[model samples]
Target: MTPDRHRLHDHLLDPSGGLVYHLRALRHRHGRWAPFHRVLAGWLAGWQPGRRELVIVGPSAGYGLPTGFLARFGRVTALEPDPLARWLLARRPDAGRLGFDRLDCLAGTDGLARLAAAHPQAAILFSNVLGQLPAPGGDWRPLLARHLAGHAWASYHDVISTTTAPKPDCAGLGVSDDGSLEAVLARFWPGGTLPLTDHDTFRLGGERPRRYAVWQIARRRWHLVEWADNTGAAPHG
Candidate 1:
């Protein structure tokens, strides 16, 4: 699966700029939020923290992560093909440890190899990025499988409604009857049930906050050794 060469990507290549949010800030508190950042931290907490290699995919704008979360790794590498986002990331503090590489996994499998080659152990953090990277015929299992074959992998993204856009009042992201993930997981694990778990349902903006309360749902932790232990989406509307 390479980068989506469609019109959306064309908008990302231009050397423009934008602010990158911490991502965790979106959790619904009194009313609105999608605290993906907090959810990811909790899931990752189950595993070893201090390690050597951690690769971040599609780090748009920079705040895809911070030196604090990455303190465990000796060095962190980010694969972002968008010059606009990369340019913004360069200005971030601790930029030295956060190496930059315009790796377009959307282009092909080579980029995946480059990431997998990380020494010791390599974990992938698809922090709010993958869903945007057009999947081949709308399937993301292959990529997840490959990454899982290496080290622990995690993904956080917007769970768009298959039928229509989200409503204004819906605050939490629960597992609907939509076999959104099951269908994809089946492609790799065959009869395996997708390891999904519910994340925090928080209200952002305090009381009478900005938007609806958002719920974070993600996969259970799994890494590569024991068939792998591993691991969205909203762009603030």
Candidate 2:
């Protein structure tokens, strides 16, 4: 591995880094080798774009950067809090194409409100960061409902274990009995549902298997793209 890749791998292995490690790993694996965001942007190409804006929350180095690239069809704003990552993003060529904003964190109702105010008419995309939220008490639904009532479309992705496997039950967050992320999104966005696509599996640590479900919430319909391992989970409107 290159020096940067080795350092990133080590950083991910550190316990204190937490999910940032997995996020980094996912990014390095996908971003370095695949045109993940480009494909996602193509998927969303048909949306009305003249007056629409695209906002990305919790823009990690890997996900956020590529997301910004894919969001070129509209105004893209990236929100992040990490100083080093923010610095790197600022230095990147694509920075010119996006409105990068630094935030303390993208959790709680207040943070959402701030984002809503910053990009009122934009489509919103949330990746792995949603599950990392504090949980049901954070009340993201009302914030989402208010922002997406008629003005915006939002997309979200969450990791789900298999139906027959024992999964960690998050406190204050609901998971389905079948280990489907669809239920989680449904709980978070009551009016939203999961649209089925291809089923794919991701092997994190040999035996620790996880699945991904892509969901879109717009015009009161939930369209699902089922199961694809290593598939880029970009939110579409």
Candidate 3:
């Protein structure tokens, strides 16, 4: 686990360490974590959907960050697994335009298929939640691959396992070794991760740096991987 994950959870419980991390993400906003999310949204803004539809997965009932940004779209649907999170979100005034569903995204392919079927044209967002998806056999590529196969999607999450690259300020959340994660994504979908040029810096939390990155898989990227896997052969490992 990285220091960022712990730092993000530091304010959740009064005892300092507890299992109430969800509250920290849902309610606390000591600049807890928003700037990076808005940066992700900015990247998403590049591709404008015809219907201005955005399907968010696991926003954890947070508001005025990514959710608020997505709400600008004509339709905003969030598939969340927590009931309490949903309740908190429903209590908000701006929730008028937002739709919440109690969906366990980690359920399986069926659930994901339904999501895709319902919002075929909507851009799917897997923010900070992809790493937490329940994937048996330690392979998360399938979960993401399934989503991209059905819709245009982008991912923003923390890469815990660091490489030679330096970290950013306003730290923490999620965990994964950069090389291993990148290897898996490249193997499944080459260059699927988008490169960040100018990003925002946060100074709310201490000097801890962030090791996060954006992962993307548009229709074209999906087609290439599918074609390579179907005709030529599975992508070379």
Candidate 4:
């Protein structure tokens, strides 16, 4: 998959910006990203699907993901389009634990459907990708709800972000899933004086329980991350 045609973006950055993101992740994986990674790992541990096969969409180098989590599946497929990221992911610690498969899910409208058709028993995951999608064509929540209806699925993506948003209280490990984005933001960034840009991911989760966390993706930019799992749910029409 070519960079412009099918490569994924690195949230507000172009497809080529993935390299920069990878560098930043390597620099901050144990420093700035420590708190968020801890919370993410805990959240991942909570996801227990019955299927042995798994599909991870847009996981760039598996930086924020724990290797132990990926090893839980008997078979793991990474539906990534970035060539560089695919290479880096293969070298991650204990990469040998997973039986990997690669595909470009962003290549066409039916990519997701086709994946489901090909691996009907596999559980699907959107790994911090939904929020980074370019507007107009980036809205895949509806398609996901429609196409992967019968399968177990989970995702954690940006709900909103701003260069002025304050740092989150990562003193804890659990996410607060009590209210709307406004309420959650108020709890996370109380006394915020600047307006926030909604990532349009708020419409997801569809009344299901959602967990919220704060991520300082950059020194000045902060993202309110949201996670949800739709397991054992009926197919959407």
Candidate 5:
């Protein structure tokens, strides 16, 4: 990362980052949130697929790239926790090659179970939303395990700062925290690990620094299953 990029990341990860992101999301005045989306999309690019079903939880301003790109390959079921954001997605013009679905925020284990059932065989993308959950009791592993069923793939992004520690081992799956998605995936899935191939980065346009770490992940098992070919309504662009 360049000095500029690092600076940007620092600001975004700052405690006040939520305020900054929320303000930009509220305004939609410019591409204030575009950099974050771009970096996330870059990470998804690594998991190239002929076709696959995807589930994106916490769809904020828009379905970020790579997820947008994956829409071309298969269907996408987007779950947004914020009502305002969901309303915006519902109103936005279909960009073609992409589909959108709005779900009530997954508040607890039951909610996660329902979400997992709704999009079986889909790759689940959870980005930046985990930290917002009430900590200590927030057990996402059940949700992850539910989605990981049927040879599915799931990608999660969590900000690493001076605080917060890596999660403990789960089900023999290794966990590693690097600023890169490749390193995370390798830690999650070893041996037949694919190369770290896709990435994108974005920097805040202003003087204040902010950065985002994006990642794309896929499970080898999912490749063996058949995927649906049709995606839902395309947003009119």
Candidate 6:
């Protein structure tokens, strides 16, 4: 397998690497992740792309993805790095509709464009992996907007994370780039503030309305997950 070039730090490596996230999912999918799964499913259900093929990047074990959702596409390929996740993701009930790819599509300067060229008819999805990736001089968003201009795409990723539990009401909130990260964090943690990590995803959605949710990935760690879709929009040039 090709080495990943995204340069994620150890703390941010767990999910993309697979083992840690798989183990956590086994323990929390039915508990902590239940609400998130529901919200994510609802968000996904609203997306109806014209293509029947789907290419999901970094969908670790697909714990947050619903089998019914996978069934929506005639062909679903998972571009993941974690061996364990690839193994588990393939065995999903809708395994018949799924395939695996070894390409590290985010590994090089033109990787995304290359991937787009390779699967011109497939809808691309950045599955909860964006927040875990380093910003590469804070150019990630622009890079995506530019390269994926003519494709049907969507992404659900982390925007902010903290040890403190955010308000449950923050789930399903619509986030915008106009607000300060501090303002967004304040709404989620109205009781008080705590040390946090901004996942550099705050404005990935631009002024687009994004579905937001809180994910308690661990007992003490929580993440602000944001979802955006462009399946219905005309391709941006």
Instruction: Give candidate 6's TM-score.
Output: 0.85
* lDDT (10s digit) by residue, model 3, range 1-237: 213311122122222112354554444443533543444444455444445677777666554244446556777787755555667766665566788654444455555565665666677666455443444434445544554454556554433221112223323322222233345334333343444321111111112222333322221211101000101112222
- What overall lDDT goes with each candidate model? 0.42, 0.40, 0.43, 0.73, 0.40, 0.74
TM-score for each predicted model, relative to the true structure: 0.52, 0.48, 0.53, 0.84, 0.48, 0.85
Candidate 3 stretches greater than 4 Å from native? 1-19, 25-28, 32-41, 44-47, 63-67, 161-237
lDDT by residue for model 6 over 28-102, one digit each (tens)?
889977877888887788877777889998888788888677888899988876767777788888778998776
Show where candidate 1 strays beyond 4 Å.
1-36, 44-50, 64-67, 109-111, 118-120, 161-237
Candidate 6, RMSD to the unseen true structure: 4.0
In candidate 2, what are the lDDT values of residues 19-76, reduced to their tens digit? 5544654554344323333334443453333344666655455442344454364566
lDDT of 4 by residue, 1-237 (tens): 333544433332345236688778878788878788889988888888777778888887788888677778777888665667778878876566554454456557766666677678888888888777743456767777777778888889888987775534454445657686677777677674757888888747677788888888777777888998878443343
Per-model C-alpha RMSD: 13.1, 14.0, 14.3, 4.3, 15.9, 4.0
Residue 27 of model 3 has an lDDT of 48
User: On a 0 to 100 scale, what is the lDDT of residue 163 in model 5?
Assistant: 19
- Which residue runs does candidate 5 get wrong by more than 4 Å? 1-22, 25-37, 49-51, 66-70, 90-105, 161-237
- In candidate 4, list every pair of residues with a backbone clash: none
Evaluate model 5: give its lDDT: 0.40
- True lDDT of residue 10, candidate 3: 15
Tell me the TM-score of model 1. Answer: 0.52
lDDT of 5 by residue, 107-127 (tens): 545555555556655556554
> Judged by TM-score, which candidate is best?
6
Considering summed lDDT, which 10 consecutive residues are worst modelled in model 3?
223-232
Identify the superior model by lDDT, candidate 2 or candidate 4: 4
